[model samples]
Target: MNQSRKLCQLCGLPLTEDQSFLSLLGIMSTDSNNLCEDCCNQLVLINDIFCPNCGRLQATPEMCFDCIRWQNKGYPLLEHRAIYQYNDVMKTYMQQYKFNGDFLLKDLFNHDLIRLIDSIDKDIVVPIPVSHYTMQTRGFNQVSGMLNGQTLSDILSVTASKKDHQSQFGRRERMNRQQPFALSVSSQLVVGQRILLVDDVYTTGNTMYHAANLLYQAGAKTVKSISLAR
Candidate 1:
């Protein structure tokens, strides 16, 4: 499709004429499924000072209170990175892409995600898996959808069929929920490898920590995580 006819993936609006012109003439590069300038501007990238542990945006680069709490509980600090802030626009995008099952919306951030993953150093990239019930109903894992066909190690699986969605629980409930992940591969396979865990969002750091704990127990040398949003 021509640039002039291309529609913004998020808002479903046609690219502005000037944008098309610049893109067509090679003055500015653009993705095939681009977000219009307005919609793109609405996304708040976490480029400024942020919590080093959790990737949460903040005034300083120190660890946030949530990470401190996790440390106080004896959990090792996690080094995480996120692309965007979980703002109102991101919430809307996630609602449509995940809850509403708009599969094509995965392409909206495909290039960005691929770039982020490439920049991270790890021996294995393991996307956090959804419960079997979620896979049956949702037809896809949202984290895997955003990977854009990159290589991944399917080393983890859900521990059980969760009767309730994580979003349904409050902060305390989520933090207190039982571990939801188990390693699918042998401990020997994980030993001495640096594992990178990918997820759609990092809410309370509960899910990431749970997955990381299993990798560490199985003898992973290090565990790092990345998410599309914080």
Candidate 2:
């Protein structure tokens, strides 16, 4: 008689009292999954009070200020979501993801992503699109790479900007609040589908909004977002 062993979902190691619950959260995503319970619980966002769309911090259930502005003139995906807050750790991780090219972390990143997709009541998956310059310089789009070889990649595709839009992250982020994010969906892919855009972070949320609006304009039934952290 034998028993199967359990592994931590964050670092993917044999489970310990503190690390055993990482996989239980169902989004730790490491091959070995060695997350101690703290990260499993702490890293995950829960019971947040936010704008249903764009996942921005909202005072109440009603549309947040960003969404209101978008309605006047911005991307209008049916919904949007982000999983974490932008901070020092998140910044470091994202920088590492972009520059260092940590493809393996997709397991961790997309693990939460999968949870976001399944947990949040949404439709399709549209990972955020990076500009041409960033992609060329980085050698890859982290979002696209995350979805690659996964079930959702078939539905989502990258549509980069024409030139090197490599401006400051903050400035670019603010611009995305209402900036144009041109995306193309195939005929087969089109025709009234509910969509969920994915991204690494959710700061001003202009980028996700633009993307959502694009999908809505393209006849998507609904456009939503999934972020690892807000």
Candidate 3:
């Protein structure tokens, strides 16, 4: 095994002892070395109860208050799923991978994200786009980086340059923000298609709703969404 690969990607710890005997003997592949078991366990997976509409962690698997508010506002309900809770571990991971431009960190979630996408029913997958300024400064779109080499529909694009980051805004401010995305391709391509919108995080559910609304208006049959965290 490569010495470099033996170090955990997140915490930079030695992964030798973390591997099972079979893996060390070449009978099985290494397990969870991209993140050591300790680091991996710190992430809270959203496998238990979560909201059906927005995938927010909750006591029951029902539509959350935020989703209910969106519903009351007459926005189309988006069936969204997320892989993990936006806990401290996930927050640090996002800070490093996204804000700090640590592109290699994307590999930490690529395999799991790909598997999750494969299980979804969708005609095409569209990643949420970043603004031109973000692309220039960040060098890559965080959401797209997690997709690995999967086929993606590059149809949606940023409507205009954003002067402020979404993180700077509160939930109410985010929900009140104007639509920030538009279709890059013709409506014919989206017509009657089951589109899956992908993003790095689900905040107030505003970004996903805005994107889904555009797709719905473009004649999409359905618009579902998934995020790395909520």
**Backbone N/Cα/C clashes per model:** 0, 21, 0
Query: Where in model 1 is the C-alpha error above 4 Å?
Result: 21-33
lDDT: which is higher, 1 or 3? 1
Candidate 3 per-residue lDDT, tens place, 109-224, comes to 88768878999999999999998889998999999998888899989999755665676788688888888899999999999999999999998888899999999999999999
Residue-level lDDT tens digits of model 2 in 1-230: 11135554434445564343445565454322444444444453534687876666556877787667767774444466676655555565576667777665555566556655777554456667666566777777787676644455334344545442424446645564344455454635645777767777776666666666566666778666777667
Name the runs in model 2 displaced over 4 angstroms: 1-46, 57-62, 74-77, 120-123, 153-166, 169-180, 184-188
lDDT of 1 by residue, 1-230 (tens): 46578787777888877766554675432243366766666788887999999999999999999999999998877789998899987898898898899998987777777888899889999999988988988999998998877998989999755665686789899899888888887899999999999998888999999999889988999999999899
Instruction: Please say which candidate is ahead in TM-score: 1 or 3.
Output: 1
Worst 10 residues of 3 by lDDT: 22-31
Residue pairs in clash, model 3: none
Query: Could you tell me which 10 consecutive residues in candidate 1 have the lowest summed lDDT?
Result: 24-33
Highest TM-score against the true fold, candidate: 1
Global fold similarity of model 3 (TM-score): 0.91
Measured on C-alpha atoms, candidate 3 has an lDDT of 0.84
Evaluate residue 157 in candidate 1 and report its C-alpha lDDT on the 0 to 100 scale: 94
